[model samples]
Target: MRLIACIIAVCFANLLYAQTAKEIVQKADEKMRGKTMQAEMIIKTIRLTWSREMQCKTWMKGNNLAMIFIVAPAKDKGIAFLKRKKEVWNWMPALERTIKLPPSMMSQSWMGTDFTNDDLVKESSVVEDYNHTIAGDTIIQNRECYIIQMIPKPEAAVVWSKVIVCIDKKDFLELHSRFYDEDGKLINTMNSYDIKMMHDRIIPTRFEMIPADKKGQKTEMIYKNIQYNKPIDDGFFSTEKIKTLN
Candidate 1:
C-alpha cells in the first residue's frame, strides 16, 4: 500500500508540473498577442557577404486568422499572405495569381529569410498542438525565466520535433526559444529583446532568428509600430481581400 501511495503522489506531482507549464505558456502567449493586433515591421536577412531588408504590414485576429503584406522593395512589394484557420494562401503581385500553400510547403523559408512559412502562417498553435512540460528554470538577458519544453502532438502537422521556450517569470515574456528538427538536431534559436510598452501592452519589440548551421547569418524582425485590439473585420483575412490589399 505504501508503494502504491508513493506512485500516486509522483503522478500527481507530474500532472501539476504539466498544468503549470501550459498555464505559463498560455499567459505568456496572451500577453504578447491580444485579441487583435496590427503592426508595421522590418525584416532584415543578414549574411557574411551581403544583407537584404524588407518592410511589411501584418495583422492578426485571434489564433486562426493572420495576414501579411510586403510594403517595401520595388520588386517584392505588394506580395501578401493570408491564413484563415488551417488554410494558407499567397498572393503574387508579379504573377497576378493566388497560390494555396500546402502542408508540404510549410517548412520552406519565407521571403528568402530564416523564418519558415509556418512561422508566419501559424497553422499549428503551440498551446493547442503541443504537449508542454516544465523542463527547468534559467536566466536570459538578466531575466529569470521558466524553461518549458514542447513536443508536437502525434496528430499535429508541425515542422519542429521539439521546442524549448524560456518565459520571463515576472512579465511572462518569451525571452528565447530553441527549435529542434526531427533527428533531435538544433535547427534554430530565436531571441527576443528590446522589451517596452507598445501602446497598451508591453512586449518584445525586436526578434532575431539565427540558424544553427549558418554562421553569421540571421534574420532580424523589428516592430516599427504596433496597435493592439484594434477593430479588424474578419473579411480582411480572406484570399480575395489579400489580393487587393494596398
Candidate 2:
C-alpha cells in the first residue's frame, strides 16, 4: 500500500511540474502581446568595425505581427519595417518609397550587423511556429530558469531551425536564446540583461545579439521610455506615418 501511494505522489508531482512550465510560457507570451517598446540600439558590424547608434520604436500585436519605426540622427530617421504574417516591407523616408523584402533576403545580415534581417524583425509565433520541449531547470545570473528548446515546426516559415531559450522561473521572462540554422549550424546568440522598471513592470533593458562566426560583431539595444498597455492609434502603424515620422 505504501509503494502504491508513493508512486501516485510522484506521478502527480510530474503533472504539476509540466503545468507550471506551460503556465510560465503563457504568461511570458501575454506580457509581450499588444505592446510597444522604444529603445536606442547600437549596431556593430564585423565588416565595418564601427558601431552606429539609432533610436527606434517597435510595436507588436497578437502573435507573429510587429512593426519597427526608426527615429534617430539625421541619416536613418523615419525608416520603418513592417512585418505581418510572413511578409515584410521597408519604408524609406529619404526616397519616400516602400519596398517589399524578398524572402531570400531574410537570411542576409541586417545593416551589416551579425544579426540577420529575420532576427531583427522576428514575427514567428512561439506556440504555432515551434515545437517546445522542456530542457530541465538551470540557474542563469542567479535566477532560476527553465531551459526550453524550441525547434521550428515542419511548416514554420522561420529562418532559424532551432532556438533554445532560458526563461526565468519567477517572471517567465526570456533571459537568453541561442539560434541555429537549418544545417544545424550555430548562428547567433541573444541575451536579455540589465533588468529595469518600466511602466510599473520589471523588464530587460539591455538586449544583446552576438554572432557565432564573427568574433567582434555584436549589437546591443537599450530600451527607454517604455510604456505598456497604453492607447496607440492605428494610424501610427500606417505607411503614412513612416513617411512623416522624420
Candidate 3:
C-alpha cells in the first residue's frame, strides 16, 4: 500500500509540473527563432491568373528588428523594407522615397500578395502580447502537436482577434495556424512544412499562407538558407542600410 501511494504521489506531482500554453509558445518561438538570424529566401505568390517568384536576403535581430533586401527580378531589385518594433518603412529605389507604413495600412496586402503588411513587419509579439490556452492536442503530419489558442490582450496592438497555433511536440516547430476575426470568423490559415536541417536545427523551411475565403490563391516563402544566433548590430536595421543593401 505504501509503494502504491508513493507512485501515485509522484505521478500527480509530475502532472502539476507540466508546461502551460504560454510556456509552450515561448519554447517553440525560441527554438525556431534564436536571438538573431540571417537568411536568404524566396517568396512565391501563386494566383489564378499568374505566379511569380522573388528572392531576398533577410536579417532579423530578436523579435523586433528585421530588414529584407530584394535581390532578384530586375523589377524588384534594390527594394528593401526595414521593420523596427511597431514601425515599418519601405525603400523604393526607383522613386528614391522611404515611405513609412501608416496604421491604416497595417492590415493591407503586402506587396500585392496574400500576406498582410503586418506579416512582414512582425509587429506582434506572441510571448508578450497574447493570452494563450492549450485548447487540445492532435497529430499533424504524423507528429503529435499541441493546439494552442492565443487571444490578444486588451492593450496589445494586434490585428488578429484570435490565433490558433499547432506546435509539433517533438521538434517544437509551428506546424499550422488559423487566424480569426473579431466576429469569430476565420480569416486565413498558415502552414509550415518541408522540415530541413538548417544551421544545426530542424525547421520548416517552407511557409504557406492561404486565405479562408479565397481559393486558387496562396503565398509561400521558402527559406534557402538560414544562420541562427549570428552577430548583427542594430545599425543593420537602419533605413539607410535598407536602401543601400544589395
On lDDT, the candidate that comes out on top is 1
Which regions of candidate 2 deviate over 4 angstroms?
1-23, 33-48
Question: Taking the tens digit of each residue's C-alpha lDDT, what string does model 1 give over 160-237?
Answer: 999999999999999999999999999999999899999897899999999999999999999999999999999889
As a whole number from 0 to 100, the lDDT of residue 73 in candidate 1 is 92
Ranking by TM-score: 1, 3, 2
Winner on lDDT (1 vs 2): 1
Candidate 3 displacement at residue 65 in angstroms: 0.8
TM-score of candidate 1 on Cα atoms, chains taken together: 0.98
Q: Which stretches of candidate 3 lie over 4 Å from their true place?
A: 1-19
Q: State residue 65's C-alpha deviation in candidate 1, in Å.
A: 0.2
Query: lDDT per model, in order?
Result: 0.93, 0.73, 0.88
lDDT of 1 at 190: 97
Give TM-scores for every candidate, taking all chains together and pairing residue i with residue i: 0.98, 0.83, 0.90
As for candidate 3, its clashing pairs are none
Which stretch of 10 consecutive residues in model 2 shows the poorest summed lDDT? 38-47
lDDT of 3 by residue, 1-246 (tens): 999999999887655533478889998888877999889999999999899999989898988998988898899999898889888899999999999988667778887777888877677888888888878899999999999989999998887899999999888999999988889999889999999899979999999999988899999999999999989999889988887897
Q: Over all chains combined, what TM-score does candidate 3 have?
A: 0.90
